[model samples]
Target: MQTLEKPKPKYTGKRHRLSKPELLAPAGNLEKLKFAIHYGADAVYIGGQHYGLRSNADNFSFEEMREGVEFAKKYGAKVFVATNIYAHNEDIEGIEDYLRNLEEVGISAIIVADPIIIETAKRVAPKLEVHLSTQQSTVNWQAVKFWKEEGLPRVVLGRETSLEEIAEIKKHVDIEIETFIHGAMCSSYSGRCVLSNHFTDRDSNRGGCCQSCRWKYDLFEDARPAEAWISEEEARESSVLKNFKLGVTQLPLFNEDDNAFSMSSKDLCMLESIPELIEVGIDSFKIEGRMKSIHYVATVVNVYRQAIDSYMADPENYVLKPEWIEEINKAANRPLNTGFFFNTPDHEDHIYEPEEKAVPYDFAGLVLEYDEETGTAVIQQRNYFKPGQEIEFFGPDGTFFKQTVGQIWDEDGNELDAARHPLQRIRMKVDKPVRYFDMMRKRK
Candidate 1:
């Protein structure tokens, strides 16, 4: 409900900092974990092969967790595992071992919502740190105090907590506090919805959510489906069923003509509120897309990373860059709003219309190897792009530069007019040298 007006910049040339909060990002797997850290995330939260909320995501194996931990340590970054799923009676059998295995993999901490997982980790793995997950919905300072007394060193405050609440929580508890700064939001408070279990056999809490809330349904009453949404005379004037049509160019989830009627809310983007967020004494700033792509992770993390750095470098001179908002939009499909930060979200915050809106750009390629001598890059194609199309190249720290895709050669030296095949390797010339993991994007 808060206005996202840009704060006026006032420069007095005096730079100061309160605290440098950790820039935490989410990673579904090891490659994304590496990208998050390289792109300036101070810490990255990932799900293991078990007990994580994103069960459908490409979670990491123990071996992969170890490798990811080692990779994160290289950049002085930390790795946290998400053991945040609320375990059922049947799901509790081997959770202790999962906790121990995570500690063995050198995870810095585990974000947990279940009491069983938290107490077991505290008892068995005495060295592993535990943070309370946002699923617990700890909005009050008293809840934070209780968790801190229980030996939980950090608490990710619920998305419903406001800036006023976060500052108050810091006053009462000495524990580290984290808040979601960017990404998709759950329709339910703290994600306690069970609509998936009602619609399908899957459990929503234990990581098998089918997102049934995003589906469309026919109106029913008194054991009979309503065939019309309007008067009989109005219905007679139109041949289409209920005079309704599904408003999507392509279907990603449900077949409901009501794509926007789902409980899925607009995404949360705090680019304009970075200064206020920092002023609230938040210990960590978190991003919420474990199921998102490498491009999304890179773009979001890079924007937040730059925003935080610019403000921290010169708080008095800090000004929100218009380009930062533009960069974040490239990765977001849903409209952005400040969720529950200023005031309780009203009707305007809900995604009440058809979603899947078009953006201006697409991730075209990822730089694999760069030839410094010739200013050429060996790239793996992720999307279609042809010669003469303008592409933007960015890296962990690359601002951006435009390069026309003039010529491309395939892996075997065969020339190609366009890089159309998925994951196909190609050698292309760039305007400047790039590094491994740097990526390319083009207008769609």
Candidate 2:
């Protein structure tokens, strides 16, 4: 019998000479910061103890920020500190000292919205790069040019900007243009709205937003011939009055029976448009979610890193992987849409009946160590996991595989039915091998 000739693998060459844009991820705390870097973030943006948005997040203390910077440097990544709050007179006080401290701690850059803070940073740490924050409402090319003239090294453009507008702005400005590629979007224009302050006395600009825009509203019309104009307090007091006496119109802006989430915009997902984004010359791709979980940070950063790497490796044969989208959806997220990238998003982009998309998997545990001799993996429980349940493992090397949980034992060698407690350490026999820091997720 004659042997058939072996077939050779097809070769595809590079399609473009484009440089990969920085994959910028959010770091709510030290753990998330490390995960972001390990999962392949080129840089991580974090909030300091004061002046940054996401006031509820565990913003880094000065010492933590110092340590975070050193940790990032070990992986050849940078740390950008957020000082982007719109400052009041009280907020401006001691800002210079804060900038000096940041510079001393070896921060890669400072994100600033207030002109005063920018001027202060320039004066205090002239060597540090200043990134104009998205809170600056940088939409037009003229505004970008103005910011460039003011000596900012980069300007994060408003989310309202279209791809064409971004390309135009890039042409007019010499500085870098960073745009938010993923995460939750603000209802207001470039997040410059007073609804939070108006409703709850929590200043959105000062990082005290209550997200009042996302709340349900009842729109009532006064039928009393324009003479029934009353103070908001008086109207509230008289809200119980009959429709005839109150001159209340019958029609509602939304269906009265339904509580519509009219103002809630869907979370941005630019995975499918990565090629277009690259073609437009965007300098940095930002992921928003400082208050998000560590799993979110790891998953999002990992997927985006894969997309960027895949495209960079062979742009000619680059294809958006279905698994990337599946992985991103596994994280807690709103309904996904491409926000203002292809065109201006209209009513279709807003979820009238807001419902979170269910994730296909649940974070079950994390691999702490593996004992080769016993074929047992030491793990820490993140969520409840029991023996006989199937789990999927994903690691830094991008390997993913499924295996069934076997016999489990606690640290003291006591057998446990389930690893139910958060951060509870357990040991389990595994047929498939896993390394340290590997994550296990159970199918829902």
Candidate 3:
């Protein structure tokens, strides 16, 4: 590759210390929320049952949201609630009540997209800080400044933005800038696609997205199987004589195929670029999976936590653990990319098939009870754990240590070959101290 030309540097820009930003993960439900906090998240953003995007996600209830806020605070982590859905007249009616409740719950911040919600939050949740969600499409300094003037404390810039652009935007804007450091990539611009609503009446803005972008397709025209699409699976299996373009095209009468783009872009992995992001003046690094499993949440949180800590210890010579990258791959991911961070994305960056295949290294469970006196730890396994298998333990402080199992005993003190049953309690001895939220796994 040829060396690219450099742009002239602007001398009049403001500079800021680019320390490690807060690692923000997503929590679709209470379990995921708790797992992210315990594993290593400095903060987590979640959508409530109403007003936010991600309608299908297992959102928090009033009671759960209250507990979630308290739970995160207990661990010195902040919680931001997303109230970012575009509003209609009906949505505007209950805006005050929504903001008032969020303020009462002591939420760390409110992620807003709609102007009505922003206006309402200022009056109703006056004490609550507001962060502009990426759904608002603040891609440049001008847009970010406009939102900041409206009292937003922070802004999540668009996904398509490059790292250098973000740095430039940071130079021009005074408010905090948060960008998605990891997790799923939306095919549409900043996740504002109307494909779900246009195709299935499920509003993407209201969070009922059916993900039409990832849908499979076969090109066709004139209501007959053309030479271009004759070999398509749908055309071959059709009981109806008429042939039509399948997936993201004009709709036909029988839309039998699951053209919902169910297998979307794999989650983004940025463990390798944590240092670069910090240098770009990002104030918060956001993770994008709220509908993920607790194990998924825990693994991702712990890996990123370790990555950040490693960078802080030695910015110049920090080397991310090979195991940490391995752990991220163990989570749900598509082909990994530096993404727009590198300013150029290859064709392979977009995944068309399935994401990464499932691995056996699922999170087993927590070390619920430990008896350092007896040199044994009581564990509640979320999945099976074979005796003699080695695993990484993520401690309460997010410090990781390696351990090999020696003996396994059931809850009743009977010898067991392995902790293979779901949610089963087992007694095991480790070489070192293992705290709650410490994870164990056997890789495939």
Candidate 4:
């Protein structure tokens, strides 16, 4: 038999090398936006006053969005505005104008879950790229293909998707694939939970999620009907007890030690799997905390930035640093887990007990301005810091050193023992020189 060589793969399109995946960060406000980019976020996603899911975030006003976009451009970073609410008829009222405004402000992209909002954007702001939000619960390659056909250039896959599934999706779909690599994990399937709406009348779909899943529950049994047990306070508060009636006794769902966090899922973390993620051809790695503190944004973004750059620079010699892991541990609010990335999470992945481990440090202050002549740093206090306390200062360069606060002065130049007020602007003498936007945190 003659051995016939397989025909060379037909080239319908030119082959191109995949570029470095973008490190996408969250920006709840302009301050967070600036720091995220400074710390090495390739792009930042933010919410506006309307139409986004983070109703509690200090979202941008139009003027602020314009300024933020301009500021992001200065660092060669992009800003994506979230208009991802599952809109009702009333919610769609001002969206057309909002889309136009976002385009005018030069937003790099718009994230949407609703078809109507996407259609409106295509009509009103044809220049903006539309990204399918994770709220749409896109799991399969077919759904991604459908979204691509609908004109979206990117799709944020649902949180429950695995690495194997993501690789499969990448093979089938040509559109950019974005997935959450770090930060809080929702208990409900891709954030579609009715508990928040049912318990608090706050629709999780339309930006008013109360996180009902994270609440502790006590199962109670009543001999009388459920209505007899409902008190005035219970009625007013929409008690969870009323939603589910039990018998004659009461049973707490968790042990005494575990009651505080019975339903709380561990936060997602993937620092150890960066190489595998890259090998799988993911287009973007998203950090999911638009409502998190600025310190959280800065620390997480900086560590991930360093990890990505270090691995890209020399993949063969790459070694995960202990310090990088330390930084992440310090920044995390809950226990960390791999989420559903490696395998489906079990009971062990959920935190049933309170987070008892103290944070390694507390965010002390932010250096607003540094005067080289006076050797003084004008600081905005985030937490209480007293003179003589040892604090570590770290910034964009990722260098940190311990320094003692020798002296502190008020805005009036009056001497002070402690910076006690929140957001108080004070001047402090530093033994080591610090730069603008440098963060000070008290060691625990």
Error of 1 at 23 (Å): 0.9
- Per-residue CA lDDT of candidate 4, range 1-444, in tens? 975984332222222333578999999999899989988999999999899998989899989999899999999999999898889889888989999999999999998999999999999999999999998889999999999999899999998899889888988989999999999988777656878889989988878888777776655444343564457455435445443343333445555554554567889999998877776778899999999888889999999999898877766677899988988987888889998898998988887665667556788999999889988999999999998898888887576788888889999999998999999999988767888888998876
User: lDDT tens digits, residues 1-444, model 2?
Assistant: 876974322322211347689999999999899989988999999999888988889999889999999999999999999999988889887898899999999898999889999999999898779999999888999999999999988999999899888878877777788999999999678556888789888888878888777776677554443334555446535645456355555556666577664588888999988877886778899999999888888888889999988877776678999999888888846888999988888888887675655556777888999989988999999999998999888876476788888889999999999998999999998777888888888977
Candidate 4 Cα errors over 4 Å, as ranges: 1-18, 218-261, 355-360, 369-376, 410-414, 421-431
* Candidates arranged by TM-score, highest first: 2, 1, 4, 3
Q: Candidate 4: global Cα-lDDT?
A: 0.85
Model 4 alpha-carbon miss at residue 185, Å? 1.4
Model 1 misplaced stretches (Cα beyond 4 Å): 1-17, 217-260, 358-360
Worst 10 residues of 2 by lDDT: 7-16
lDDT of 1: 0.85
- Stretches of candidate 3 off by over 4 Å are 1-16, 219-266, 354-356, 386-392, 396-407, 417-421
RMSD of 2: 6.0
Q: Give a tens-digit lDDT track for model 1, residues 1-444.
A: 997986544422211236888999999889899989989999999998888888889899999999999999999999999988998888788887888898898999999999899999989887789999999988999989999999898999999999888877887789899999999888688767888788898888889888776675444223111443456455455546332333222233434464434576788999999988887778899999999888889999999999999988888788999988888988886899999999898888887576665556788998899999998889999999999998898876646788789889998988999998999999988888788888899888
* lDDT ranking from best candidate downward: 4, 1, 2, 3
User: How far is 214's C-alpha from truth in model 3 (Å)?
Assistant: 1.8
Models 1 onward score TM values of 0.85, 0.89, 0.82, 0.84
